[model samples]
Structures are given as C-alpha cells and as structure tokens.
Target chain A: MTDIKTLETASSPEKLNRVVIEPVTRVEGHGKVTLLLDDNNQVQQARLHIVEFRGFEKFIQGRPYWELPVLVQRLCGICPVSHHLAAAKAVDQLVGVDQLTPTAEKVRRLMHYGQTLQSHALHFFHLSSPDLLFGYDDAVAHRNIIGVLQDYPETAKQGVLLRKYGQEVIRLTAGKRIHGTGAIPGGVNKNLNQKEREFLLQDIDQMIEWGKTALELSISLFEKNLPNSRDFATNETNMLSLCREDGGLDIYHGGLRARRPDGSLIIDGIDYRDYEDYIHEQVKPWTYMKFPYLVAQGREEGTYRVGPLARINNCDFIDTPLAEKARLHFRAFADEGLVQSTLAYHWARMIELLHCTEAIRDLLNDPDISGTELITKGNMREKGIGVIEAPRGSLFHHYEIDEGGLVTRANLIVSTTNNNRAMNESIRRVAIDELNGRELTEPLLNQIEVAIRAYDPCLSCATHALGKMPLEVQLVDAEGHTVDRLYKNANGDVSLCKIEA
Target chain B: MIRHFTLDGKKIPFREGQTIMEAAQDAGIYIPHLCYNPEFVPHGSCRVCTVKANGRIVASCTTPATEEMQVENETEELQGNRRELLQMLFVEGNHVCPGCEKSGACQLQAVAYYTGMLAPEFTYFYPMRTVDSSHPDVAIDYNRCILCELCVRASRDEDGKNIFSIDGRGINTHLTVNSASGKLGDTDFDVHDKAAQVCPVGAILPKHEGYNIPIGQRLYDRKPISVVGDVADHQEE
Candidate 1:
C-alpha cells in the first residue's frame, strides 16, 4: 500500500525542482528518471520516462499476415523469440488453425522454455547481480559486473555458463539464437533432430544444477538482508500472468489470471482474447509509453504489476518439483498476503529459471519433440490475438488481416508497457525513501535505477512511435534559478555539457 | 571462327548474335545479373548486369558481343554503380529479407552482398502493396517485386501464357495478373509454369512450403552468389 499521508505532505502545490537521470544503464533501452524536489531537497515526485519510440505496430501494417511472426522480431534484441512466438500464435488464427499438432506444440514449448531460461539468466546474472552482491550503496566504480568478476570470480563464471547453456538450447531448437525462424503461422517449421537432442542432453544435468545454485544464491542474499530488503521500495499492487488450466505457472500459453494484493482473484481463467474487455490503456501526457490497468478497477486502483514477481504471485503453483518448493518459500515471505517488495523480483525470477531448466530437460526427453508432423490448417479468421508471458510479463499481439492475407492493422501491448504505472510507482517509492533531505549522489541515483531495473523493462519494445531523448539534469528553484546540473549523452559519456540553446 | 572481345582486359570469344552476358557465361566468366537468365531471351529491365563497353555504359544482357571491342565487367566504377542500383531497388519497395522466406536463397540479397552494398542508403518507400494469396498454391507479394519483368517474359515467351504484365509507370510500375478479377486464383497459371519459377526475388512463392529448408542450408547460404551462379533457376518446378 502507498503511504498517501507522507506523499501528500511531501507533494506540495508549489512547483518542485527536478533531478534527471538519463539513460539508466544495465537495462534494455533508453529511459530516464525525473525526480522533483522542493527547496529543502525533499522528494516531491518521481517518474520513469520512456524517451525512445520504435513504431513497430504502425510499420508492421500492410505486411503479409504470415510475416508478422518474423517481422516482430525486430522489436527487441533481448526477447525477440518471445515476440516471434507470440506473433506466430496470432498468425495461426488468421490461417484458421485452432490447434497445432503434438509435435509442433512440443517444439514451440521447448523454444519458449529455452527463451525464458536465457532471458531470466541474462537479467539476474549479467545486469542486476552487481547491486545484489555488492551493496546498492557501494561506489559507482565498484558496483559493475567487472567489479563482481574481480571479487567473486566463481559466481560470475556460473552466471556466464548459465546464460550460455540457455543460448545453446535456443540455437539448437530455433536454428539461430537471436532471430530464430522456428515457430511459424500454424506451427513450427522443424523438429529437434536426434543429434540436436543428444547435444542438449549432454549438459542438461549441469544446467539444472546451475539453476538450483543460482536460486539458492538469490535466496541467501534476500534472506540475509531480511527486513531492510523487504521494506525497500515496497508497494501493494495487483499482479497478472497466464496460468495453465490446472492453475500451474505457464509462460507459453494459458488463460488470463490476475490477483489483488490481498490474494483475492480479480479475474481468473478468462480467455486472453477478451483481454480488451478487462484491460484498457491510459495515456499520460508526459511520456510516450501508455499505462495499462484493469478496466474494472479504473485508472488509479486498476494499475498492477507484471513479470516474474507478478507471475509468481498470481500462479496457483509451479509445475516443476524444485520450482514448486522454491515458490512456496517465496510466497511465505509475505505470510497472509502477496509479496509486494520490488526487490523480490530477482528471487521469483530465479525460481522461474530453475523451472525452465527442468522443463527443458523434460522436453528434450520427450519423444514427440523429434516427430516431423509440423503444421496444421484451419478455417481462416479475419481477426486474431495472441498473448504469452514474456520474460518481462504478459505480452499481447493482435492483428487484423484483409481477405488478401495482408495486415491492415496491428496492436501490440508489450510487457514493459503493462508495467509502466508500476515502474513509476516503484521509482517514486524509492526516491522518497532514499533521497528525502539528502545530498544528490551517484549511489542515490543508482538506488532509483535499481528499483526500475527490478522489472527489467525494455523501453524499445514498449513505445509505439518515434521520439527524441535529450539527457540532462538541472536543479532549478521555484524562481527558475539553476542550482546545479549534469548531463549524459547517448554514448553514455557523462560531463557538464551545456544545454542546447 | 568465333568473334573475340577483350572483357576486363582478358580476351573472350563470343559467337555471332550472342550477347555480352551469353559470351561471359559461355567463357566460364560470371557477370552479376537478376533479369537476364541464360534460358530466356534477354529482357534487360534490371540493369544489374550493366558493364562498360568501349567506355560507354550498356546493358550486357542485351548488348551483342562485338569483335575487338573492349568491355569492362568487374571494374570498380561499374561495381559501385551496380551497388547504387541495388540500393535503389531495395528502398523503392518493402523488401524485408529476414522475414521473407526467400532470404537465404534470394538472388537480390546475394547480388547486393557481392557488390558490397552493406545498407540501403535511401529511405524506404514503404509503399502500400497488396499480397494476392487467392491462388491455391502460389502467392505474389507486390512489395518484393523489383520490376525485373522476368516472370512476365518467362510466362509470355516460354510458358506461352501471357499471364503477368507491368502496369503503370515509374514508381507506380507494378506487376499485375492477367485475369478477370485481377487475381491469380482466377488465372490459368499452374505451379509448373515457367513464370511461377522464374522470379529472381521473393515476389512469387509457393504456399504452405516457406522456410521448410533450414537457413544455413539454403541455396545461397553455403556459397556466395558469385560461386553459385544462378543455381536457384529451374531448381524447382
């Protein structure tokens, strides 16, 4: 829950000064945090502004419907496979395919699990681990991956190997690691060959062990910090994700499930195609990104969280044994309610990583994965929608095609966009908690970034149009006098570069 | 005796009535081309095979090889011009290679690579184009059409069915089907027709059979187009 009383006192009607952190590092795309402060340096407001727009939705129009799967891969370099699969699922509907063959489904699942494994491993290990291992307040020079490598070589090596193993799974399943042409309109293009299966199996056990080790490391770090970690940037927001018919954690495909902070179901087992009936996007004037909320809850109370933390909170139970055990441990952190701490995202992400490894191992052993029956045909539909749980959160891709099989319109609500409001809330909470009546320093700036990094938002995937991002910081009083200033360019070079006239 | 022409300062022999491309192909020389298939009468719509003949620019596919003529095939200036032409072709239409099934096997992409055209210099037109998938087996994507007229020539001359034609002019010039409804589904075109298999780009394709071959194993993936030498021609019915 938000501290409305404290917020009201801090947020005076007087115009507050601003502190801008342009180009938050260790994340996917271009974004900045603007913290408004009063004359006493008390934080008044904070917002995560998405400064870049990639107009993928508009540009993809007029393309052939079948090309959507491949074309959407240009959306994000980090999670292109997620986009690839989601668009493929949507295209399947246009071609009239209600269901795919057993072989095709299994192959797609393998690819999705492999993608999740790689994406989760990337966020937890390479990007956010420095803040978790070396305290968030550590010197800027000593709080990077390089510093972690010099200090804890073994941990860094495990992170690299874990990410590499996931990438290998993607390469074998999709044909290429980055922009794979595996999943197609109605099904997958190919199946795992016997040789490919053998290769993946060679190190499947090692991957599982690494997953477990990573989960344990995250658990130890979170538990050691205890109350401090639990209280850091905590907020009570709704959670949303996909769950299997049996109510197990499902990343690839399932019915929609959203839960309130008090563990009450807002919506359950609803077909994701009807998501527009429940979810609506609210436009804000300040940023290009749109804020999505539950239509029933309206704008203010409707905003919710997604991604690992939300998925873990929303699922009834995880299917894998190891992951189920880890989930139970994670859920118990909040006792009678859902875990609302932003920092707990890393823990929940590791649990999913462990599950991905187990799922990959099981998929590799399945005989259906090698079967050649790959495609299916159905009655054509004019409109189609596909939704999946990407690494960041729930991703939706909807398209309308004319009789000629050409795309007339495209609407994509990416995972990062779903968390737009939640990210802003997290930043505001961190700013008020860490920066009130304090001197502005690099570590304080990093704390705000650490809160935003928890969601692992991809700004490039979130935006729907083109915009310029000018990076500069100025502390101006109510009288409009510049008290201080800082600047960061696109190349990440920081200096006292003067503002353009 | 065959007529002799010095191409790139090397003497090459050509028979009477043979064009410069024919002479190069017959003499074990490779000249990059898209609209000039050896099996068809020369239709020099795509000037990818342009060369310097006696210090004057000419389309080699249609230009007859002359005795004692100096023709420069692989000069730096010609290659540079060819790259610019390829870049123009790229930006003139929506030719997204990664999404197109013909990516690894596309001759246009290969020729661009052979000419060292790394990126399209011009802004993409992104013209609104229609895809005609009304046909049961074959589909045409107007966006990828490079106005080569290879399919038009192949259908009219070889298949004996004038099924496709170039309509409009300049940027509006587009491939149109000769049918009652302006659709391929209403046409007499068959999968085995010469026009169906003659598209040098991804303009025309067979349905339900795209991306079947893995990327690395496609026709142009294993070897550059300079070595493959129009192997995609007649490889399928």
Candidate 2:
C-alpha cells in the first residue's frame, strides 16, 4: 500500500491514546479496537485490546498430564480441534512416544483436515462473503450471511452444508463436535467405522467441486477489491508458517519457516520445540495478547504476519494436485514471493480451503484410516512440546509434568497472538490513510474492523496470558470535582449510551 | 389397595406409603431425580427433583402419593428452577468433565443434559479438592462430588459399613471418611460395597476402570440421559 511507508513510523509504543470501538463482531471473544489520533487528525497509533481472561493457563496447572489434551480443547469453540491436536502432540512427547500407531496418526490427520475445511468455509461464506458479495458500503445489518442467503442463496447454502460436512467429519472421528476427547496422547481413542467412512466419502466429489467454485469466486472478488486492498491497511511484514520436510504446505504437522518481506529466508526447517531460541515474545501494557517477534530481527521490526497469507507465502508447494493448481494461481499475485496486500489473505484463505478438502479426500482414501491399535502405552516424561499448523496459523503448546503426572507448568503461544503486532499495524495504516479529517461514518470505521477481521482472531484464547482486570474510570473537572463516571460489570456490559448519543 | 394421583395431566396409580417418585416410577413416568435411589432410604439432599404438589413446591421423593392430587413435574417454571439448581451444583464443585473418567456416565452430567443445561448460570468455583487414590481398588475424586449424600446413605443402609458421612455445613460441607487415617484405603469400604456403585458424580470411581468404554458408547451416549430409565418410559406418551 502507498500509505504503508508513511504509516510505518506512526505507532509509538510509549504513549496510550483513546478512540474506542467495542464489541467487534463476526469474530470470537470480547475485543475493542482503540485508535489514537493526533491534533491534526493523523493516526498516531492503533491497538487491539483483548479483554476477556479465560484463566485456562493458570487453572490447568495442577491437572494430570494425560488430561491436558482433552482439557485444553475448551480454549475456543471454533478452533478446539487445533488446540486438541496441539495438546495431544505435546502429551505424546510426555508419554515418551516418538510416533503414534499408524492408524492413530492417519485418523488424527483426517480429523484435522475436517477442522481446517470447516473453519475456512465458515470464514469465507458465513463471515467474509457478505462483505465481498454485497460490498462493504452496504447497510451494516444486511451485510451478513443472511443477506448472502437473500441474494446468492445457493452459495450461502453451500457454505452451510460444507461447514456441516466438516463438523460431521469431526463428530465421526471425535465423539462430538465441540470439546470432543477422541484425540488422546500417543494416539486417538477410537477408529473410524467403515459405515462412517463410506458416508463421508459419498460427498467428497461434490465438496471438491464446491471448493473449486468458491476459490474462483474469491479470486474474482479479490481482483474487484484490488484498489481497496492496495490502499486500505496493506501491511508489509515478515511471514511465518509450518511446512513439510520437503518445503511443501502442511497444515497438520511440519517444521517451522519464516520469510522476510523481501523474499529472504529468516529461518527454515527449525524444530518448533526449540522456538524459544529463535522467537521472542514482547508484551505491551495495553492488551492481554503478546507480540511474537523473530530473535534475528529484534523486537519491534521482527513482527510477522501468520494465518492464510503467511502459510501460502512461506510454503514452496501444495502436495495435493488440485490444491497445487490453485497455489500456482495464488503465487502469480505475488511479486517475487512478496505479497503485501493484507486483503490477499482472503485469496490465500480460499486456496487453503481447497487444500483442506483435497487433503481430507486423500486421508480418507488411505485404508489405514480405519485401522485400530488406537493407543500406545509408554513410560512418562517430565517435559513435552507439541506444534501444528492451526487453521489460523501455527500453534504451539509446551508443558512440564511433575513426578505425580500433574501439570506443573504450561505455555501456549496461540495463533492469534502471533499476528497481534501485524493486526495493529494494519489498523493504524487504515486509520491514517482513510480517516484523515473526515467525519467518521459507520462504513469508514468498519475499515478498521475489516482490517482486524482479515486475521480471523480468536481473542478469548489469546487473552489467557493476562487480562483486563476489572477497570473503572472517573473524570474530574479542573476544580477536582467528579464530572463523569464509567465502569464495566462482571460480564463486561458497559452502560454506554447508544449510537447518536 | 390402589390409589391414584394426577401428575402433569396423567393418571398415576400407587400403593400405600409410596412416595410420589415411587408412584411415578411405577406408572412408567420419569421424574428427573438424583439422590433418591429406590434401594436406599430417601435422602432428599440434591433438590433437583423438587416438584409442585397441589400448587406447592415439595420433594417428590419424600412426598406421599395422595388421592386425586395435582402434581406438576414438567412445567417450564419447575424445569427452569431445576436447571438453576443443577447449575448451582456444577459451579459449587470443581467438575472438570473432560478430565474426568466418569464424564459420559456421570448422572449429574446426564441430568444436566436432560434438563438442557448448557452452561453453569453462576461463575465456576474452580475448587481445589484432593483425590484419595490411597485405596487399592477404588479412588475418590472430591472435585466432582455434588454433596448428594447418596454414598453416605448407601454405605450405612445397604453396605452395612459406616465408612462415609457428611461433615460441615453450607459451603464448607464435604464427604467425610470414618477411618482414623481419613482415607478410603484405611476403611472397610471395598470395590463391591454398595456405596461404590451409588455415586452419581465422578467422586468415587473404581480403580483401573478409567475410560473402559469410549465416550460415544457410554451409558448416556447411546440414548440421551433424558430417555434413560424412568425418563425414557415417560416420553412414550
């Protein structure tokens, strides 16, 4: 974006300023976007304030090691599978199992593909489609999945059915859709039945076709929104994701890879368990989420973007045949492997969606998917590490167990936190470029939300580290008498006067 | 002699001295209940089975089957109150279901499922409780205990062993063991004790039997808890 260079120096971490937009919708958890405007109406800084405290990291301390896999799944309703697998991977190490029974790994991989597919379908059709199909300047209420149903009825239905299919896959593999405990340490708890496998396979051909169509539609939408993408909140930053041993795209398991904006390699093929050696976490006073930066680039400048765009950029190729074709088309949009258009995330998201379906089809076709030998018994270890490419981005869960097998310490670097700094940068860039001296309309303010939504952040999971412990505010006049007062309830209901107040 | 009463607009027949719960059970109607086992003396501690008898709230397990009495069990108002009580029990203890071995089989969880209780209405207490794994054949996880006192009643009335009792009151109440060492292992409570099989929550579990059945194939898994036992027979009409 032309404004990206000018907005680079706008954010100063020292000072805090106030312009609040609360209850950002269509994404998970409680969050507010705050922008600090200078006297000249120029954007000085912007920040995403995630306020909810889950207390999982703190409360999970004394739980037994075997329980971590199932216990951690409650972190997020939408992305429980990610947490489930990540925690399972970590527990696998704790169980002293280098690898799982073949059937267990295959079943887990199949279940993971379902999770990725379902999440992408939800974002594209249910959340982002309304903004793309109906246009952003449309009425706020009408720019949702319901509006998409009214206009593009078939597309909306397809989105719903696709999500349902993905959910069914999860239910078939795991016990139930939300917080299922099928994925255990060393292996899964059960195997897929032939009847269930047949049922899922029946829809594969149609799902693949729908994936192609949705990806094509998303690419067309991106071209139409290219001007907006180029101008609005285009963040130029480093990229990070997980890649297969041969540098292929891997959503389930792989080695870590980071690339700079100039297509130079920051690090490649690094074991994610050794993440502390190469990555550093920086905390800000304003938000509960932490910013993760590369150790090589240092704090402020080391911030990198993750999720769909980053995954597509950091990987060399997609292993699935049809997905590889889509990847080739996506690569053309980049200039020497550097695509800075923040909006291109939607395009990359579609490619990943295609990849997920193909991956699911491939995993299900493998005969070993239905094999038993689900669990492996082993000696326990004190420390464990697990990492995987979550639908959002790379997720890591590290834990230490006591002699009694109770979890002593747990550290989670969730996907949303990895992109925290980049998300803020996008918001600041958009506010500076678009909101300069203009009366902030609903549509104009929505750009900041749109910029944040592109990351598909799950704030509830990210806010576990530290949170906005109940705050109250009172304004005093020059004479020191109280003029105004504000406070939040336990459920975070602020008695703010309605719009036009 | 046979006597009859009206429950939720249905005629239910009963014998003398039988409580409303017993009559309802005889008539193949399921009234949501816990801590009211037929084999043991009625210990109406869990309040989840409170129903309206003749326009007044009463525990059905203790209320006698009266002639032509109007008893309300499935009213939205009553169910709503039941849901609140269930929610209170959920938050009162550290009931972490995913970590529990008895999650799918727990009657408290099943009752919550039957009452459509999605989440606890109040904040989670996250109480730190001890696990008595000292017993060779049985273990007691105090976190999932709902303080129903069924184990205490079953141990004294059925098992003929005075190993379990209720101690303290109000929020400080807990299950107390009678042995000098205050552990299940030190007591005469065996794996075959009636008290061992009577716990509705995951409080007292048989050792070496964790996750014996996968989640989807458990007791509450096949038919939802609402359709289990007396609850299922009542759904036929």
Candidate 3:
C-alpha cells in the first residue's frame, strides 16, 4: 500500500499549502481527509482517516454464536443484512452444513437481494440524487429525503415503492427488515407460501418497471446537469469480485475473481474456503476497522474496487433480460466496459435493482421455493467459508470450528470495507478536482460529499463507535512533510504517516 | 399430561415445559412468537394467537390444554385477537413502529398485521421516560418499552442475574435497571447480558448503534413475525 508514496511530491519544495476537510457531514459515522498542497497549490499528498472505535469483534468473543445475526446486525443499519448474513454464513461454515437445499438457498438469496435493492435505492434516490437532480448548491435542509420528495415527487414515490418492495421481501423471508432470525446454518427458518410468492412476484414486476423509469430519469438528469467533465476517474489495475466459472453475474454465491482493468481474469474461482491465501487484513492503531488487501498483489498495487460499478465492470453478462438491457445502457457510458467514475455507481446500482427484481422473480417462480425439506442436516466437522455479494460489494465470512461445532475463529470482510481503498481514492480524486484553486463554498463541499456518497459507504460497519464522543481533527506539518492527525486527546494523537507506514 | 394438536395439518405433541410454540418447533411445525423465548419465560402479552382450544380463542403461550383437544391457530377470530393485541401493544407504548430497531425482528409489530391488524382504533399513549445510559454498553429507554418482560425474564432466568426489575404497577409498571445509580453504565450490565439482547422493543438499545441502519431496514420492516416463527428452529444443524 505504501508503494503509492512514489507518486507523492517531494517535501523539499520551498513552500506548501495545506487544506484540511474535517468531519465530512451528513454521513452516519465519522471520517476525515486532509490534503497537502505545495506552494504551487497542487495536491501533493492526501490522507483519509477514520476516527472512531467500538470493538464489535472483540465484544462478541464470548457471546453465543446464535446471538451473532442479531448482534452483528447492529453494526450498521444501512446494510444490516450484510452483517446478519455474514454472521449466519460464518456460523453455517463453523457448523459445517454443506447441503443448502434449493428452498433455503432461494430464501437466503431473496433476503440478500432485498437488502441490496433497498440499500441501493437509498443511496441513489435519497443520498446521491440531491446533487444530481437539484444541484449541490441547494440548502442543506432541502438536500435530503424531503428535498427529493418535493422536487421530484414521481421519482421519490418510485424510490419509496422500490425500497418498500425490498423491505417486504426481507420481512417475508427473515421476519423483520433490520435484524431478522430467518437466516440460519442449515437453511432459513422462514419459507415462502404460494400467496407470499405471488405477492412478491407482482411487487417485483412493478419494481422492475419503476426501476426502468427511475433509470431514465437519472440519465436525463445527469445529462441535463452534466456534472463537470473533469477527469476525476482512477484506473487502478486492481479490481476484484465474486464470479462463476462462466463469468456471469454472481452475487449471493460465487468464488473470488481478481481481474485487471484490461479484462483479463487473474485469479478466477478462488475458493472462498481458501480466502486467507489471497487476502490479508492490516490493523492500524488509529482506527478500529481493519484494511484488507489482495495479499498476492501486495497492498500498494492491490487497490481493487467493489459494489455495483465493480460488479458490473467485472461480470461477463447479466442474466435477466431487462437488467441486461440496463447493463448495456450502463456500458454505453463507460470506455471498454470499465466505469472509472464513482458517480456511475448510481447508474450501476439502478441497473442492479432491476436485476435483483428480475432475479427475485425467477427465484420466487421456481417450483422448489415452497418445498417442505428446506434444511439439509449436517454435523459439525471442518472449517469453511461463505461468500456472498452484499448490496455494497463482496462479503466474505470465514470461520474455524472445533469438534463441537463452536466457532474458534471468525474473520468477516464486509462489503463496505472491501471498497474502503477505492473509496479513499475516489474521495481524494474528487476532492482534488473539486477543491483545487477553488473557493471553499458549501455547495462545492457538498459536491465532494456527493462524490463520496456515490459509493454509499457504510462507515459504521467500517468502524464501530460505542459511547465515545466524536473526535476532532488537526492539520500539522513536520518541516515540509504535512500530516493530518485526529485526536481523542492531544497526547494520544496518531499521525497520518503512521497510516501509510 | 401431554397435549396434542394438528397444526397446518400435522399432528404434534407438546411436553410439560414446552409452550405451544416450542412444541410446534420440536415437531417441526413453527408457531409465531415475539415475547416467548425458550431461554426466558414466556410473556404472552402480544396475544398473537388464533389458537382454538375446545372452541375458544386463547393465547397459546399461556394456555395449557388437558386431554385430546382440537386447536385452530389459523382461524379468523384468533387472527382478530392477534391483530387487536398488536394494536394495543403499538398504541400503549412509544412504538414509532416504523423507526424501531426491532421493527423487522419484532414479534409484536409483525404479528399484529399478520393476524389482520390494519389500524390502531385506540389512541396512542406516548409516555415520556428517561434514557438510562449509566451502563457503558447498554442503554435502556423506558419510553419505547412495550412491557414485554423479555428483558426481565432473560436477566433473571438465563443469565442468573437479577439486574433488572419492574417498577410501579399496571400501565405505570416499567422496567428499571436494578442499580442504585439507575443508569446502565453504573451497573455491571453490558450488551452481552441476556437482559440487553432480549429486548423485543427499542426500549433497550446497544450504545454502539445510532444511525447505522436506517429506519427503513429496521426489524419488522418486512413481513410479520408469523413468518419468521420460532427461534429454536433457527439453531445450527
């Protein structure tokens, strides 16, 4: 990861200008970024710092594994399903339940897809839409759900419907929206009935149609507003995702596939069980969250992206017809099927919504959905890994167990954290492009926020914050080497250099 | 004496220590529950039962039948009671039902509509109470408390810790953290305690979560509790 330092400017410059963006607002959790500009007013180096700690993994050590789905779900409400499913999948792996019958798989997939739809809808409509539809210069108060509703009632209603449909799917499958109990080791506890299946099918059809309209509206709005055509895009050769043998769109279940921007699949069909072989987590003292990178590729060059944009970019084809059409439309915006701009995540998410709906419809219509024998019994034996594509990105849940099937060790790689490196890069690029030589207006700052929100990053899942009050940020320069540091107390402050080091 | 019934066309037997819901799970016939935990004593406050024992709608959690009896859990009248009971629970407390963390996983909220509870006919009694943040990890906000007793029971029975007790009486009777300081942090209580994890309402919240999961994705945001059914069935195979 430190190899990027070669790209850093020499600190021996006669003078340097330092710009600090502190406590980026409207986001759920706390994060900060500091940019060091040379006397020439060009961004010399950028550092992203997450400043909070709650210790979720540590807290869950002695607790019963059964409580994990509910407990971990509280990690982040934005993507509770990611934690819920991760916990369930981990427990399942620990228990060595291999045979996930068709019904159980369908139910789990439905719940997973439901979360993806709702989370993506929230990101595209409520969070990022304000900048695209109403412009970032709008007042802060009017830049939320209310503004979106008042400005674009039709779009807002579609968002509400789309989100509602997803929530309903989750509820039906899991018993509640946020932290449900349906997901278990062998199979989901809940099974869809004919009536519920019909309802979901009908709702999914409507969502697909509504999603198309929303996509058209988004494209028109983007075209009309035409967010500055600056080259805020980064083509980091490291891109990783879950893919099938045929390289089709794989979300709920697949193997890890690392590919280059040039479309060559490097590590295809990486057994999730052997995740430790390719990925390793680095713990920084400054943040409670751990940064994971492709071990084989090494840190600096292994700057892979995830979520809708990465998934779309890496996939060979989308299965559902309507979604395939939207995928094609998305491809039209990118060069060589690579969407480098973070702003395109919205479009990619919208396409994913359609695909989820279509995929859900297919799953619901499957004859095996209502089967009685959902769970396949198995005794605790070997360690295993469960990988699924969370709404935000690829989620990996790995567990090791003793003879009794109790989890001895668990390592979770959430979707949000998977995109952390890319998110930091995206934020740095957008900040440099938007803030360089420009007045620090609220609108311009909001635009930078808009770019970050484009990834729909869940900072809470990234960093667990207990009752500790939010921290303050400071910008300091050691000679010409500028550093951004966040402090809980003045004496205990950790420098930005430590992060890169 | 063992009790027997036909649930969803399958005949199942119930043991002495088992509630109808537990018996159903053991027999592979899931019955929905919100306040009844095998780890804790059953609190049949939600009344989500269409259970007809000898031709009368009774709360299955509290009802113990004798001899060979016919019970109808899927009837319209039983569904009506379940719905009405849900409405009562909703209106009695500060169940902003939509924004609650337990919305999706909440038994009370989901069972209400699953049994055809369309709207609350009664007036909502939004009580005001203080948030007991004395504990470092757990938070207890009495306002959102539904008097489910899951916390009280779990604290006493499962953890063998009587750290929580009910104060006042009737509608005024609310769960109080059993510490001299009256704050969660002041007590030995942590989120890992059964008292904290078993809260069916948003009354007891973990300090770590705030705006992490949005309101839309909260528990009970999806289908009703009847669908998720019993917890015993969710155990690892």
For all candidates in order, the CA lDDT equals 0.85, 0.79, 0.66
Please compute DockQ, using alpha carbons, for every candidate against the native two-chain complex: 0.48, 0.21, 0.03
Give the higher-lDDT candidate: 1 or 3: 1
- Candidate 1 chain A lDDT trough over 10 residues, lowest sum: A462-471
Clashes of 2: 1
The CAPRI category of model 1 is: acceptable
Q: What does candidate 2's lDDT look like per residue over A302-357, in tens digits?
A: 98988999999888899988889888888787767578788888888889888888
Which runs of model 1 end up more than 4 angstroms from their true locations?
A: A1-14, A462-472, A487-501, B1-16, B26-28, B52-58, B66-72, B75-77, B122-139, B159-161, B167-192, B207-210, B231-237
| TM-score versus the correct structure, for each prediction | 0.91, 0.80, 0.64
B32-80, model 1: which lDDT tens digit per residue? Answer: 9998887788888789999999989999999999999899989899999
What tier of docking accuracy does candidate 2 attain?
incorrect
Worst 10 residues of 3 chain B by lDDT: B228-237
Q: Is the docking of candidate 3 incorrect, acceptable, medium or high quality?
A: incorrect
Worst 10 residues of 2 chain A by lDDT: A462-471
Q: lDDT, candidate 3, residue B7?
A: 62
What is the per-residue lDDT of model 3 for residues B1-237, given as tens digits with 9 covering 90 to 100?
A: 666766645577887655566666677554555677767556677555437777776677777644455767776666666667777777777665433444555555566656666668889886665555545556666757777677778778878778888789888887777777766666667677767666655677664333233233544445445555532333221
- Per-residue lDDT over A53-142 for candidate 1, one digit per residue giving the tens place of the 0 to 100 score: 788888877666777887887798788889988998898888889799999998988888888888888788878988999888775556
